[model samples]
Target: MKKFLFLLVMSFSLMLILAGCSGSSEDSQAGGDEANSEGSTEIEFWTMQLKPTFTDYIEGVIADFEEENPNITVKWVDVPWGDMEKKILSAVSSETAPDVANLNPQFASQLAELDALVNMDEAVPAEEKEQFFEGIWKSNSFDGKTFGVPWYLSSQVSMYNNNILEEAGLTGEDVPTKYADVLDFSKKIKEETGQYAFFPSIDGSHLLETMVTMGVELTNEDMTKATFNTAEGKESFQFFVDMYENELIPREVLTEGHGKAVDMYQAGQLAVLSSGPQFLNTVNENAPDIYEATEIAPIITGKTGLMNVAAMNLVVPKQSDKQDAAVKFSLFITNAENQVEFDKIVPILPSIETALEDPYFNELPESPSPEEEARIISAEQLKNSEVLIPPMKNYSDLQKAMTDALQAAMLGEMSIDEALADAEQKWNKALQ
Candidate 1:
């Protein structure tokens, strides 16, 4: 592939500029400059391989984008979750930087500082910017310049086993939305079912779903220090302690990865899950029976109502010359129709207007029951469920601290209060 692009560069050099009258000797130098310029015009695209779990939906979307704009060919590469950030950072610092790639929507600030990412305000049509979720789009903006376009929105929803809930004389519809209710219910389920009520597999940031739903903002309004020791933050972390002590969540979740949670859920040993849509699809494929029997609902709220969200952004690299094509592809993928199709497979919020009207989303087909109303009820509620954090510069390291703290709490390695304070101290030190 590199040779093909290089050969095209060689061909262009021998034709136009080399044929011009320069100092004649300076033409060789011109040829090298022209070659570099030529290849930059070729569109290079990268995806984080996140959507592959749902299906080959991303491939179809990319194909449609290529068909509409035939002038540029997109080279798509998938970086796995384990090594995505490290690999992308190294690749961008080298000659292999892509014309466009996926990154954490909030990650733009650091990369922008390195001059590796483009400010989208100059690349995109301003009027079209309103198509995305406001807070999500704001994550990709820094210093008044847009750097990424919101691709999709992910909310942490609660999934429960209807059979288990029914066995305990309850249903999700009858379940409470308040944190206190959940704590009380967890105790009740432990008394009745013997099996744990929830399995919060030591996923750190992923657990933010429960916290955000509880009105606990980890960062203050000024974006400095760790306010996680505050009233709500304390309440949020205490959830782990209460659930664990009440024997609602198993001790193994402290160390087990996501696979463990899936295993238990498939076995019908776990009644409730604080999970994203990815698990819903995983259950569909791996344990089709469980998928059929399971039910989903908006995450139960805190004393004060709130919910946590996850999302992605697509951006054009500043060094690419095919940015015109990159910009077109960005807007194309985010159009309402495309987003809806993409979200149908992924089961997340499509980051565009007029997408929720689709029949597949409004009402989906299910077996042995009335048509399954999609778990998402009111669009406005989903919009309001989002929790916005500032551009976290040391997020990678800070997230590690939070993860360790969560795992410790999940395992009872440390008391929840102690873990939160240790994490807060570790995080604050980095900020300084």
Candidate 2:
């Protein structure tokens, strides 16, 4: 039954990929012919929301790339974040897709499952592949094949309020390193400092990511059935329920989001905020006083002892006739030198080993600012971090199911077991 559902889902998605390509395919082929006749291959490259801000940087990269690969010309396009999926889908359906595109795992998995993406393992050289971080590289893979090259990445870091912690008779050294410890610290913070230790945002994908970090297997081996109602899932999820019931954590956590958490942290209501280092800028800009009192620490861990990581990857569509040029351009853009240069323009860390070793990540000033400290701490955590959500075609749906179940359990409308069991059933039905 599961196998049949998997096939049905794949069929639907493949149809989505090939939906309107007939005429566009012919036009694309003719364009390729014209380019070939002119002794060059023109491959369109699209990036998500990296426009005007990084225009100079991207243009420079393109200029250097075109200079090096005289036979290839990259046609660059920047799509807004809100429109990227629709744009990519339309391009894929019409066979007018860019040869290379920037995408996260959730959407990239959609293309990967349809066999619409080039296998990076076959396209990228083994030695070159070794240069990327293992965890990030794995995110771009499905089954046994890699479909994308990992680019920049970010890992959550602990941004704790030093003043609040000190009021609770704790120091940075005493900050929580595990979820259980977070509970203990929350209880203590409430008792002593009258501030919540952390606001665990359930509105985003954090809850599921937390479960995965705790070694919860969200699905069966083949990802055809839901399997998150087991001992591990129950134990991990129960912690939140118990915390919410006791009012140890903020009640708003049940309905609020990262923005609320950030506002609370800046208002001195949260003892710690586990988020990407980028939030430090918000604190520094919005609440300089709180920013002054903030200190950095590694993200809280679980049974796996690793933090959650996310990356933007570059992929080549299977329909492109310029696979070699596309892969070459992908590599050139993500190579250590280029990545390091790009990092100078942004706050993200590089996926390449050599790029990570650059002085920007390693050499700290005698007295680093909060931003510098956050980046360094975050960069260090990348080695022990991974994208918690594994590639699944229905990943967004599964997350919705799990989130709804957890919310119900927390609201006292259903027993934890009942909630989880219902969620698992719904997830299975969705799979079908």
Candidate 3:
């Protein structure tokens, strides 16, 4: 009987051990399943200078995105406008780059050339590409492969100081419509007001865009050779040389960029400021008197009757493990509805055609504000504007060569022909 009791106790102990093992196995499996469901994939997104001002909106976007895509999360970082290039390059080298980033086409092209970006043509469907403006879409491509998705855009607008124009005996009706008319207007405004009429920044990309619009073909059909050394090119360039020599434009144009141009305009030293519509607010904030004197017009054009288009785009790093998630969120942010929402926050125009169709973009205010007029005219111009500077692998080199030639000519270091010829030579070499 004692032996029987001992066997019973031993069997009970064995049963307890077996129960504990079974419970441990079940708990381990359940824990793993929970982790799999809850471990959301995280992606890093970076934007240039869209912070503080756009914090709430972007945070809301991230939150909404997370709710809809419970398996994905976005971590947002805002970099200053000036540091974007260096920061991104460093991150890419260290293998710690953001999964996606905001960039201009020029910078994005450089990365695309280095094979650091994903080719959107292969990753994005054609229908999705159709969502953005055609010119914007084409601008974001590098060597036939798109590397970025276009986001917001701005078409240049003519901002005139009404007081200055009136002092120069010019009415709003006298606004320049063509490149030649711009020269004529500049001469009159300078003669009457003794203030510079226009200061087209030689350091900016505007000159190249204007030259293209004026029919100075920069390259051959395949873009393998430089072709901008012809009579049309020389004539196109001579216009600026004459403006500089005659003092119709600012003397500092060779060194001054867009910022200086805006400062000059706000200080009542300029009769006309050719810039994006958003600059109206700068004038309004910094020089309210001048803002009251400011009037908007469709940007002056050349032979093609089209203005240059500028756009900011979103790009995905090729090395990202979250490429799919990044692309998906990028599409979400740039979709028509979201882009329109963004436009309301800033004075920018959306690159999406359907976004431009929003009533906010379409309905001009009864008593139109400068912004209202600027947006309408700017949007209308986009229908005709081609991407003036299509993707060129040697874009930076070409820009430098052109600017160098312009400076040399303006400073009288070289004649118009000599300057353009030198630029042509440099361009041909770069293309090769």
Q: For each candidate, C-alpha RMSD in Å?
A: 8.3, 4.0, 15.8
Better of 1 and 2 by TM-score: 2
The lDDT, on a scale of 0 to 1, for candidate 1 is 0.66
What TM-score would every model get versus the actual structure? 0.80, 0.91, 0.89
lDDT of 2 by residue, 146-227 (tens): 9899988888888999999999999999998888677778889999987899888876578888998888888887777888
lDDT of 3 at 192: 91
Selected candidate, larger lDDT, 2 vs 3: 2
lDDT pick, better of 1 and 2: 2
Which clashing pairs does model 3 show? none
Off by over 4 Å in 1: 1-41, 50-70, 80-83, 106-109, 142-145, 364-381, 387-390, 403-419
Give the per-residue lDDT digits (tens) of candidate 3, residues 1-432: 122443344354444334433443344334421122567778899999988999999998899889999888888999999888777766765557787899998878876766667788877888998877877888888777899999888788888888998998899899887888888899898889899888887665778998887878999877788899988898888888899888888888888788999999999999889898888888899999998888888887878776788888999876676677888899988889888888888878888888777788778978888888888888788888757887775677788899999889988999988999899999999888
Q: Candidate 3: which stretches are off by over 4 Å?
A: 1-39
Model 2 RMSD vs true structure: 4.0
Winning model by lDDT: 2
